[model samples]
Target chain A: MIAASFGAGGMNMLDSQSRDLIVGHGSHRYKVDVHWGRLDPGRVPVKDCHEMAVDSQGRIVLLTNHIRNNIIIYSKKGKLLQSWGTEYPGAHGLTLMNEGGEDMLYITDTERHEVIKTTIDGRVLMVLPYPAEVDAYEDASQYLPTETAIAANGDIYIADGYGQQCILHYNARGELLNAFGGKGIEEDKFENAHGICIDTRSGKPELLITARQQNKLKRFSPEGKWLANIDLPGAYICRPVIKGEHVYLATIWSGDGAENTGFISILDKNNRLISAPGGNQPIYHQGNLSPMYQQLQLFKHPHDVCIDEDENLYVAQWNAGHLYPFKLIRI
Target chain B: MKAKHRGHSSILFLQKIALAVCSIVALWGCSTNKTFSQENDIRLSAPIPQYSSTLFEDSFCLSFAPGYPNSHIHFTTDGNMPSRKSAIFTGKQCFTQSIHLKAISFHPHLQASEMVEIDFLQVKRLEKVKAISLLQEPSDSYPGGGASSLFDLQKGSLNFREKAWMGFDEKVVEIQLEFEKPQKLSQLSLSTLQDHGSWIFLPEKMEVISQDGSVLSQWPIPQLAEAKRLAYLHVSLDEIETQSLRIRITNADVIPDWHPGAGHRPWLFIDEVILK
Candidate 1:
């Protein structure tokens, strides 16, 4: 496996402002296998990027919370392929659905208070409204969704992301099947329950959620049973990807510091610690101040991580607005 | 013989160099995205709190603490941390005038506050709390409600669907409140952006809860009606003395009598819940 970047060797890869990713790069000769950071020089050239989803064909889709305009799609890398939805003024959540390399992309627009499905080519396939349980009607704010997860039977799990902080489940037809989660510090209680992913770590369709404020990773059954509470130290936990048997998690930083160091950590299925490769330190920028002039080898925030078929790992960073790709090669 | 041996040695040397280059190339730029085999050489600490700040009662309240400088302080007087920053906390001199209060300092380590309550009489909402927009107003869907729905097409609700549908219509939607005491109710207005349907299902009973399950106040709404537009209710507090008050919508109207949206569903549109 390989972690690819714009280029190698800190050679001012981008014309815009640069952000460096600091992973554990051992010395050259003794390093039988090591990982290095390459600068992705191209600017994303978008207004605001909040949520992202990659289709089976490796197409990148994103939801922005900026204006009514939402849901932008791009190529596998940093290339801006195309854009759509001046209609979704309050778009925030998105996910790709179906089996057999399906081209369907599902989106949630808080502004319009609706979940929509379309082709990867960007045509409105179907319009799914809120489930009967959520007061999206009469309470427009309740319709405001933050994130989305797809079920095997084409059912959609919409995290009433911002509206009511609840998990609203809908059949593939956009029918509200069941709903779970509320605003609380309790087990299934969500405090800005931001991001979610479907996990089979428990050998079932378990809903894995990142409750932002509570600072925990919570797993729930499809019928909404409290499975486990993932304990971590950071205040904000961003997006999570449950790969095979491991989870690579980091921070959602608005500032710099090793505290919010944005370290990439590996945790097992039961929500216990597997390990944090570089402790909790991620790659960071060194501000002139020098402990022997060491550039920060920690992270600001590692927003999203994806594992390709080859087990190559790609991470999306929020603050730096950079995409860091790395290969998981065991030496 | 010497030349052949020399050539073999040189070729072997080049082969060695090639191996070194490949090893370096493979080793170079490896990602630390996975877990570290051993604990990395690092230490994790909290954001240093000892920094000065400014509370722009209307614009922005910034805390100058070290570490995670990007951490936004999303707080509320109703003891709710809804969004990153969605609380409507009112301070003295905060209504219409822009109140600029010097941001106090943070002690870095404690993550505690030297300043908790920003004088309410001096703080106000940066933007006006939106009013109840009835599908029409200078409305977002001003053309008409029938023309295009306001909320979600993936129609579902927490109250009437899950909470009410699961048991009875008892789970209360946590609205805002007076953290210290009650305020004015004259300019009280309600605007809703409909997601799917508009129907406030109320039971034959009403129970008021104040920190306990005991009824603090009780009222009964004996009917269920088809709300043409968003539902609106207003209560005026004389001196504003209620604390942690909950108004649970108890009456329910289900389609199948088992689950909601079983046959067909209605909608309620709301854009904002403004109580001035």
Candidate 2:
């Protein structure tokens, strides 16, 4: 176990000169630097820093609900490079995709009940409104999209997590192709389908949707068929970020959904929990992962995690005193 | 003159080194003190109790959250604050009667967490209850297994979406309980939930009236500064004998101004009603 050497005072002095606090276990350990993304709140204020993505330029882009500046761009070294977008008041999810040499972003706004496709520089490219075509939705109010995942073929998958609890699949031209997984306790259904990501680790694209409240990730075929479930036990994972042979998730809650008990979960290529940063060490007995809980107060409510090329992690939080993201330098 | 200048410069360099050492010592001292203070603020997470229901019959097995290495969970059944000397919870405990269970988690290097308390009522099953009816229907969103749920020995969690809680948004709710014969009743308890974050509040008052139109007991719930989890409100009756009883629950007309749902009608959720 890592010793609890640093305290609240050490965190406050987390500039370049302070000693590093190492967290996590095994090969996934990181040097925690809480002030890596600090910005002057007056000049670039944020509220509920929801999610983040890495652009083609390697610059970290943050999506927040604050209308003053919805998207804040920062360099890998934590320097503020640019900020834009006043339109996304409920910007909750961000997915950056490099389409044939052009970097595009898909922003899901819950308040607008729409998934917007925009250029990296904040210009609107396409808008996919509420899927009124779905029989479960009566109006646009019942379809609050929280996250979006784009497949390699430009197919879009949106998770209506805060609303009807369904996953809407669309083609490249924003045409609805299929919608499935409504609210239920069934294997194919979802409770809080908060996030979605296309997993191509097996060399074939499959949808990994977050059944967050159930503490499991429901895998589905591209056509919205049940594939399998990756049970995370006590981790209320927000989304799955597949990089290389690992799956990184920002667990928003741990241990019966307690408040302010968020952590980061890392899974091996076989979907087994290997490490949990800010949480108890992952243990498995006879192939069943033990229930995990917060072991440290390193995070409040981690909403999303962005991994850079150097394997460093940028964690954005939700309702965590409106603080900026914390950078976890891989050790 | 050159040698004297060199001597002065050497003295200045020594002073600078001494100042750096002093600053480092001061910073280290400050960091150590902050670590101690922060360690004092580190609280163990409250242990969650696992039970089918708070209302149980005969003996029920109650277990708590799994313990961590070097940490202990102490508990008491007599309503007192749990201390280090309290009974250590190893596994499921069997209880035969109503108890106010309070538990606390303690670690050698961290502060003890706040007490997590619950009142588990040992109900008699009320075999004499002939029928139960509600004057006004509960909200469709939360029917809570119908009016019979009041005596069904089911308990609701903090989540209102659970089917065990009967939620009402109206200003008042009336329930009638018919008995096979006149039975002596001394105490009446109602298990309710209060989650102001979800606009669910405890009732303002509750009245138990006899079949003869006389008020047997009345309880005015005190307004709380903040929301709490599940609560068990008890009212002492005057050992009244009646063939039937009427339960009148008055909901809070408006949420307090301090709440986010101020001026809006608050919901009232009740799960179990025990007559002893």
Candidate 3:
């Protein structure tokens, strides 16, 4: 194991392979390794390891609410390469987008109530403030964007999950193009529009947004038309990560009221649950998929999933102590 | 111009009073458990009870991880909530028969944690139960291991979504348990999950009846209505010898009006049923 290093002091490396717990179901099974990113809490503390993404260079980037080092970059072998960012106190979401040839990151800070586009090395390129141009936002605090999806044409779609619960669309230059998907109980509206992604599974890029509180994944047109909904009862899922023909999600919670209950769900091109990594085997009764829950205690409140090129899953959790990310080696 | 200036000054005075009153009301709202100060709002997690074996041969020692360092734990044996004034847990206590242990953790600034209950039963010369038939089956989502779950000699944790819980929705559950021979039953108790915000509530009532449809004994399960991690309901029955028994539990049916999901069907979750 590499010697663990933090801000100034060195800490002992953690070895969690002794647990030897095997988790998941079907072809997506994995052996768990919980000590992948353990850090010294005094020097580099983490409140919530919220979201993670793998850049084109195959480096794993993690985002946490801890202001000391909000962004942590790790090698594929679970070695800490570097860490940066102290301006984001509520760094909740991280999305990596490639523009032209270089990788750019869009970070949504709930405390800042803004979406920031930055170079991979922590240089702020652009910042998108609350859409004061829209009538829904009375002030900046009412626009806590949680996640963003970038289009191929360089447009940004922001999900105001913790605030007015709407989606704000913006052009590349931080100009408002259109804003839709406000808070409501209808199919087009949302309760917690936590995450969004551009789906290219059908070759025609569409919007796959997570209505987290409603436990459904909604597909919308580029112009914000409600197309279809893939209902996952009892699964309050987070963002959708598309890897090739399959879609993966880190279900943040299940059961009720944001308890420490979660699982990793994998869906096929048809949007049907093919496997659940930490939950029971997905069983469909009649035409509805049975409510799924965590069977093994492998995860608690999994906020995001980052799958490397080797198909291994790195799970970032929330409210599960100050523990580090858990790596699931694909079997 | 002087009269108009006075009028504007009076309006400004009235606005100041309104703002003061609003701030007071907001502060009062925050004081009533709806919100708490960060210093005093430290998490007092429920105690995790560990046993040598939930189904032990004779007697078993009960041990658990402390909720926090230097915290005191008080527990009870009669299925009541534990308070700071309750008996402190010194070490392992030897018990002759079955018992229900309810514990609470206390810290300096943190609020007392909700009670955590663990039940231990001692099997003796009682007849073996054969099968159990339900009038209405539980939800397909949580079938709970079918008939074997009742006396499987296992317990569930705070996470009721595990396979240990038998969950039912929208309907009451009536069960008929058949025994191989007549046996004496003096006590019956079970654990249920109570998370009002999650639409899982405690049972409304519990009743025991004979195989001939005569009411044997009945008791009302108290409705805490608040968020509790777990609830253990134990009712002492007069010693009765019976070949079979019928158990009936009334469901919450609808979420209470105070809850967010008012008028909607709530869930009923029961894990293990212990008898002696």
Candidate 4:
């Protein structure tokens, strides 16, 4: 394994803009590893480094839309392991699941409007196409899948965040079970529902989804019943990542104008944001989260974050000059 | 044997020089876009210039305070991106008539900040407001400073949520501003924000009327065939006399079919209403 230490000599390799800086606060503070993943673009080009996931073998898997190598796997030490796949042109989301003792992956492609199930080595398992049965969608172009969540029973929940603000449920066999939520003015409706995840934190399985444009997270029953709404006044969160009793998020953008201001947030069991990795301290006035923004410009459009077994974070960004992921080693 | 050993040493020296050159090039490439440390972040928007409510004189001189230390501020009044060649604010500036001053701060190694624009209008101040009312209230998110915001003589930035612009969604805005006494008005103008992609559009039409139900002037806001930048719409009325000014601004109603929010309700944002 490559050494994780950045001794005195290695400091000279960092850019003058970011030589030695620490971000985050409280229990989530981190020391940045800027040179964690440096690959020659000519050899392995990446467009938008959208999302990341860690496999059971501890290999950090990154999903980019770059057709040459859609999936780039790296070691915990930031060494390149292997990369494969070129069929997915608009690879946006990646979800790694361990099924029957084997690691599997679900990739959502917005360009083709479909959800693909593949093995760790790029073998196609099942393809969940657009929902033709839904009356709201007369054709396939109206459904753009952005994310997915797997249930304990192998049910797959797909979030159509780009084209339509809704969630599609499919059983283990890839059969559509139900579709709910849409663009509306109702309290339970969504506006740019970008990410979704199955939450089992409260002892019962439920759904936690991101209403990105509205800056809120909506919780629903496994059957798609609206349970509650968590308001994050100014944060446009990408996805809800559950690790143990804490929930992590990569805020893609913030501010009233939706500028390219982004940061990482950590919430406690009750869903109260207690820590922001690169932003202001979480302050609540009468139970409402005041506007939050990037206190340290450490992240620009942080689309998703993958936490390893060591609790280190790998942050993938979007539209940030084609840079690779940044490693945040927990302090 | 001596000559052969000397030749081998010379070749080794040349190889060492080539290795040093390659290492320098590699280090330079790595420094191009390294991840930023927290302390080197680009500062937020430049501080807005502080000025008076109205200019009573024909021409006025203004000054600016530095927003970020160790930074150079470039300013422009023609609605263009300020460059290094632009006017570097030394201390103050002088202006005649009305001008929109947009400025940005630039630090050496940090990123440039977003532009901050403020408008200074040279108009006569009214004695007092008799009464004011709005036919339709603005959206709760951007009620602005309320009816008083229209006369605050301050322009809104591209960011309309700065508590300066009153935003109306799919709704017409009818405002009546009564002066302390009847005054002869020759010109009337208002500014609206046009960020089409964000679902904000210029008002379709504007009508100015008098308390006696006489139409002073009416004009249609022209839609830009192609809008690639954040834009503003300023419409002025001809000479007219009125006691109470009744202004009506019609919204675009629905976004154009070519827009991403084609079927959604478009927003109308108005920052300052200038009456001369």
After TM-score superposition, the amount by which residue A125's alpha carbon in candidate 1 deviates from its true location, in angstroms, is 1.7
**Candidate with maximal lDDT:** 2
Clashing pairs in 2: none
TM-score for candidate 2, residues paired by index: 0.83
Please give, for residues A1-331, the per-residue lDDT of candidate 1 as tens digits.
0001111111222222222223333210011112222222243233334456566766656655444335555554445566566666666566777555667777777778787887776689788766554553455556677677887777788777576777888777766778788788778788877778788777778888888656677888888888887655443566567667876554553222222245455555655544443333222244221111111224445555555444444444554433332223323
lDDT of 2 by residue, B134-227 (tens): 9999999999999988888889875677889899999989999999999899888888887665788777778888864555334443344443
Candidate 3 TM-score versus the reference: 0.57
lDDT of 3 by residue, B56-114 (tens): 55777887543344456788888666766788886666776778777776655444555
Off by over 4 Å in 4: A1-19, B1-38, B41-117, B120-157, B160-275
Model 3 alpha-carbon drift over 4 Å, by segment: A1-19, B1-276
Q: What TM-score does chain A of each model score against the native chain A?
A: 0.70, 0.94, 0.92, 0.93
Which one wins on TM-score?
Answer: 2
Please provide, for model 4 over A31-133, each residue's C-alpha lDDT reduced to its tens digit, 9 standing for 90 to 100.
6776687788999888899999999999999999999999999999889999998988999989999999999999999998899999999999999998998
| lDDT string, candidate 3, A148-260, tens digits | 99999999999999898888888899888888999999999998999899999898999999999888999999899999999888788999999988888999886443476
Supply fnat for every model shown. 0.00, 0.00, 0.00, 0.14
Q: For model 4, what is the alpha-carbon lDDT of residue A324?
A: 93
Predicted complexes: DockQ each: 0.02, 0.08, 0.02, 0.09
Cα miss at B49, model 2 (Å)?
1.6
